[model samples]
Target: MYVGEMGIDRPRELPWQELVLGGTAVAVLLGLHLLPDSGGVDPVYELLSEYPLRSVVVGVPYTLALLSANTAVVLLGVAMVRQGLLRGWLTTTLLAVWCLSLLGLTVFLKDPVGSAGTWYGTAHKLCTVANFVSLPALCALLWRRFRTVSGWRGNARRVGVLAALSMVCAVPFAAAFLRYGGQLRATGTVLGLIERCIVVLDIATIVTLAAWSRAMAAARDKRRFDHEVI
Candidate 1:
């Protein structure tokens, strides 16, 4: 149902939260990747988990990684509020859990890439699994909300669905490729490439959501303009 139908007041302009959050995130990641002693190009290809623990191990890069990741997830939480998708306590709680999952992966880094037996390594794996699993669940919950918003229909709908599906398949695809293709080692390998692709796909979904929100905000402004002019 429309926000108006529910007697809710809609915002006049698009929320700039996503732009700030996502842009800062991309910049931090790029900056970290470009730092000196960052193993040059070798570290770039390896899984990101290998970076703070195994490779580089620089404090600035490590901290920035966590900050950027958690900040970006704020956009996901605010997206619903800006779009007037807030339903009740259930929606709010789920979104909180989803955001926490994203943040959990940043806690303390891992026990290096090879030593999953360590306490920190175990925590890292749990967080990683939570992040991957919770992502699709968030998308699923947002499905109905997406359809309710007129701006998210048509091509935007297809884009959103495809993006979510890509995320849903990413972990499995990476796991299978790692198991059958070869060992999951540093960069320049199939596993590393697949993992990078998954990151790209995740960013794509975020961008798509931002675009949809902008469209909705624009449409709302135009409607209000017409009403005023009339």
Candidate 2:
């Protein structure tokens, strides 16, 4: 059989269009969530709690956005696995844990102000911790692997350095949250801004990995075709 007929096709890459749709949904919904006065919610100090968005009057759009974001993240992991870009059982496990953490955060809303120590509140905190912790751990664990991977080395090194810094920053952010989050008040603080910066970094890390995986897969596929033709 001719090569085109004989060669098995690689699993299809996840379309970037899908990722963009998911990302846009997340961003727009989050912006809307910030509207609605939040009943004097200090966006700076309020932990970006989804509780406000879950309101009866204006919750639907925010809920849809969150679910879309969740599905996008989970789908990204699955795509990496299918493309054989993630590598190893440990890597796969960490990816799955991170995705599960995202889902958990969506399903378990945090307690409202003055109700910080409630059961659901605690559950929300646990999910938050797990989500944040798993991300850095995954980055650290994959650093060396990426550094050595045939086509992904350079991107891996850059991501690894960023990952280490992000983990270090998470320490202070978590501490600050625990200490002052109960107050649910931060009128003139940069801490909330810092927290948002961390969120940006986290999103960057995920996006970088997705892009890297697709690039590597495409390169490999091209090389395979070239060899077959030669």
Candidate 3:
């Protein structure tokens, strides 16, 4: 049943504590993305190229980390939504896609081609774009849809603002992807400043989502308190 009919109120977002922690985790991942790797092609991939790690040691541990972290964040987002939070789905989905993207990166990292430059480069480039640049776009779309689904009236203007921010944030990475992606420099598909800008957008989006979740929770709590007093 809809909370509106049940006398249960939904908050505008989740609690502040949740928002801070969740936002911080997202930021750490973002930092990992921004961290310069060997100052060239992904260091993880580069090292794997020289010597593949034992499946037991590297592969299993990495996979577990990716899956566990991603799942935890997704559940946290869901919990927020369950308590009348909004934007939780998008946040959950964003974290999931990102974690999956990292998991996807693990594949390329372990099997980077040493002899064939162009072919391996292309594959890695595509994965980077898909995971790094495009995933944010997916997240943004989800956030917009989530807001609409929240059934919050007169939120068109707010949604519009979010849409605009997403587009603006996308510009840098999009350009970087097109420019340095194919270049066979030492960097090998490593994007420059533009990519960093896209990451910044991702960071902003994460924070915004967290805030939105917190607001939803607060609103719900307030409504419930008011009813008990009356």
- Clash count of each predicted structure: 2, 0, 14
Sorted on TM-score, highest at the top, how do the candidates line up?
Answer: 2, 1, 3
The alpha-carbon lDDT assigned to residue 106 of candidate 1 equals 66
Once fitted onto the true fold, the runs of candidate 2 whose alpha carbons sit more than 4 angstroms away are 1-17, 33-40, 50-54, 179-181, 184-189
Q: Residue-wise lDDT of candidate 1 within 145-178, one digit each (tens)? A: 5667564556346555755666656766545433
lDDT of 3 by residue, 1-230 (tens): 11343566443333455445545545444444454542233432232222223334344444444444445545555664565443445544655666566556555542333343455455555655555644455445554566565444334334445546656645544455445443323454433443445545555554555455555666666667677669
Model 3 has an lDDT value of: 0.48
TM-score of 2: 0.81
Q: Give the TM-score of candidate 1.
A: 0.68
- What is residue 182's positional error in candidate 1, in angstroms? 14
TM-scores of the models, in the order given:
0.68, 0.81, 0.50
Which residue runs of candidate 1 sit more than 4 Å off their true CA positions? 1-18, 34-45, 55-59, 86-94, 144-151, 173-183, 186-189, 217-230
Pick the lDDT winner: 2
Top candidate, metric TM-score: 2
Cα lDDT computed for each candidate against the true fold: 0.57, 0.68, 0.48
Q: Report the C-alpha lDDT of model 2 over 96-172, residue by residue, as the tens digit.
A: 88778767766776666565377766776677677777878888877877678676678878688768878776777
lDDT value, residue 66 of candidate 2: 62
**What are the clashing pairs of model 2?**
none
Candidate 1: what lDDT? 0.57
